[model samples]
Target: MKIDIVSVFPEYFDVMKLSLLGKAQAKGLLEVSAHNLRDWTHDVHHSVDDTPVGGGAGMVMKPEVWSECLDQLLGLDTSAGADEPSISQGPIVIFPNPSAPLFTQADASELSGAQQLIFGCGRYEGYDARIPDYYRAQGVDVREYSIGDYVLNGGEVAVAVMLEAITRLLPGFMGNPESIVEESYTGSEPLLEYRQYTRPTSWRGLDVPAILTSGDHGKVDRFRRDEALERTSQLRPDLVERLDCSQLDKHDRAKLGALGWDLSGEHPRRTK
Candidate 1:
């Protein structure tokens, strides 16, 4: 997979060079590049942002700079990645903003499969809404997303969050394939396993759960699932609502029934 980031702070991505993503590139599994959007501007100052037109408090990123940078990066008019036939399929363009759609774990999983990902990281105030609006009009698979209810100083942090989330899901990025299957939000439940303790049977004062130490894989698996379900129900009831109860066995159904989860919830009924 290939990923290109367009940001004012190109230096912010230097950390990617020392981590798992860097290793992936070295192994020829992933390719990532970060470019300064201002480099595409024609002005002497290489200006990429300006005061809002209709009356806004902060500066707005100029659409011209974004268009030029994106067009050149994707080889829209030139022979860039043109040799790569998949480039024409279109890049997944993501615009980070507070008012945009909420990004979920499923979105990250889906994006990990894209041939190319192009991130438009906004700075200062934000981009002219036309940036995302125009892409949407072109049938481009662009997504405008917000990390959470809170706002960030810029999109750089959000871009980092998104890149890491997608990268880790790629096949070879994480050495272990099993990690992806058991992790939080990978399947039916969005909740992660509850807190765990290890070794030193008697810690500062607390003891490790005996169920974990018992060498019986069957019991341990059951215990962990129960803990995960309990944690999900307590902390993120919404996630519990999203699980298909029909697939659950008698034990799971009984447990959930006791917790007030009925047949009608956020998820579809299990098929088999």
Candidate 2:
């Protein structure tokens, strides 16, 4: 897969060259390039932001600068008006916005299959809304996502967080591909991953769960599955609320029921 990142602080992405991401680049499995948004500026100061039109507290990233950068990156014609978009089918455009929907593992999974991605990282308050609006109107697959509820100074960090999640799912990107299957937030019915253990079963004083050491693989799997349910319920009941009842076996139902889950509803929920 290919990715282009546009940020005023492109140097922040230099770390992309040091890890498994770098190895993927070496093997030709991925291509990532970070460009300075200022490169598209024509003025001496290379100004990319301006006071908000509505008298906001912080400066808003200028739409004109973003348009020039995004247009060239998206292969859209600057000359083309709102009626006629270059209509690129190959690359999907993404912008990070604090007010947008949360970026999820499911989204990352889906985007891992894209041929190319262009990420525009906004600084100051944010880029003008029309940037994404105009592109979407032109038949482009434009997406805006927030990493979380909190705000960040810029989108560069959010882009980095999202890129790691998406790129690691690409085929051959991970050394052990199976590791991706059972991880938390994966699968049609996602769950928090079971706790991991390694080395001496007894570390200091705390002992590993005895079931893990037993020679019975079936029992170990069952134990892990049960632990996953319990852990997720304790940590992220929101995931539990969305559990697909059809996918739950009798044992699974019993386990959740024991944990105060009310299975009688149209959807699973914790009555308490």
Q: lDDT, candidate 2, residue 34?
A: 99
Q: Evaluate model 1: give its lDDT.
A: 0.81
Residue pairs clashing, model 2: none
Across 147-212, the per-residue lDDT of candidate 2 in tens digits comes to 998999999999999999999999999999988999999998789999999979899999999999
Candidate 1, RMSD to the unseen true structure: 4.5
User: TM-scores across all candidates?
Assistant: 0.89, 0.96
Best-matching candidate per lDDT: 2
Model 2 lDDT, full chain set = 0.91
Go through the candidates in order and give each one's C-alpha lDDT.
0.81, 0.91
Residue 188 in model 1: lDDT = 57
Error of 2 at 197 (Å): 0.4
lDDT of 2 at 146: 94
In model 2, what lDDT does residue 169 have?
95
